[model samples]
Target: MTPQEALFKYTLRLGDNALIQGHRLSEWCSKGPILEEDLALTNIALDNIGLAQAFLKYAADIEGKGKTEDDLAYKRPERQFYNHQITELPIGDFAVTIAKQLLISAFEVPLFSALSHSTDETIAGIAAKGVKESRYHFVHSRDWCYRLGEGTELSHSKLQQAIHDLWAYTGELFEMAEEDTILLVAGIAVDLEELRPLWKETVATVLTEATIQIPEDGTMHTGSRNGVHTEHLGHILAEMQYLQRAYPDATW
Candidate 1:
């Protein structure tokens, strides 16, 4: 693919990951185990949604197409997205959702760190701003992880289960797709393969600090990079896309 095409594709993948995960987190709004945690998750959810919107808009501009961010986000079919499966997995419990956020934010910190220096100026700019958001996300989630993991035996057990269950999905975040090859070769995208070691270390450190154990299941759950999403994404899209689908072209 050409450089423009590569950049747009790469950025859209980033946007999709955040948008879908943001929608998933919003499902917990007003429903978290506590009011503070509820607002915290919602804040993170809004942050992800805002960042996704910016990334999608940047992608659209880079593509030089008339397609707006809303069009790309709301009108697209499930198969068109290229986010990793980690983002779409269910938010099982409070600890589980926090675990998901921790895993995702750990990967994103270094990923966006590298992307901020991308040869593509738009990607670099987006990444530069996003690094701050990703940092804060990890900090917030990490604190929650610690509280739950180190609090009580019951809390520790729940967090440990959450960590073990979600660990498999984390493997796919740094698994680069063929589409990534196009952008990486053109200097517009960082290689996901190279990000793996860093991602693992960060994840390992956070879990360790939280007093959580890493499972050795020796298995990885994959298949979201190609837009084959979990059952959760379809329901998310159904709700997220409802207004758009119900009133095509309707605006506030």
Candidate 2:
């Protein structure tokens, strides 16, 4: 891919991750375990959605197609999306949701921190905001992990089960795509491989303090960087793209 194409894809991937993750978190809107926690998740969802908009808008600009961020977000097909597969998985239960947040936010903290210094000005600006938000997200998820992991027999079991179920997907978060290699050379993309060590340390620290056992790494799930994903992504796209697909050109 040309540098321009690589850059566009890179930006789109960032937007995809945020958009799908924001959608998943938004599902917790009224379903949170408590009212305060419910509002907190909703606010985080909004933060991610806003981040999505920023990234997607930048992606569209890079593409130079005159397509708006909404079009890119609401019009893309499933196979064209590049979100990490973990973001598309079902939010199982409170423990599972918290576990997912803990793992993803742990990765994001280091990922965004490094990206905040990207050579690409727009991406650096976006990542700067992402660093602050991701840090908060990490703290929130880390606290929940402790509460759930040490709270009760059932809670601990559920959290552990969640971790085991999701661990394989985490490997994909650090996988490098072709665009990543190109951007890595240009200093426009954060080195995902470099972020893995810190991510593992963050996750291990939290899980250990919560008395949760980290699962052994097995055959790792992969492919989102190539637009391949679990069946879950199609379902998410079906709901998310419904309005735009069904009512083309219609506006409020």
Per-model RMSD to reference: 1.5, 0.7
TM-score of each: 0.94, 0.99
Compose the digit string of candidate 1's lDDT tens values, residues 1-252: 676666677788889988988988998998988898789889989988988999999888887878899998999888888778878878887888888898899888998899999887877887888888889999988888889988999889999998888877877887777668888877878888888888788878888998898887468887777678878778778888999999998999
Model 1 TM-score is 0.94
In candidate 2, what residue range of length 10 has the lowest lDDT sum? 107-116
**lDDT (Cα) of model 1:** 0.85
Error of 2 at 79 (Å): 1.0
lDDT digits (tens) for residues 155-227 of candidate 2: 9999999999999999999988899999999999988889888889889999999999999989999999889
Per-model C-alpha lDDT, please? 0.85, 0.92
Task: Give the runs in model 1 whose Cα sits over 4 Å from its true position.
Answer: none
Roughly what TM-score does model 2 have, to 2 decimal places? 0.99
Clashing pairs in 2: none
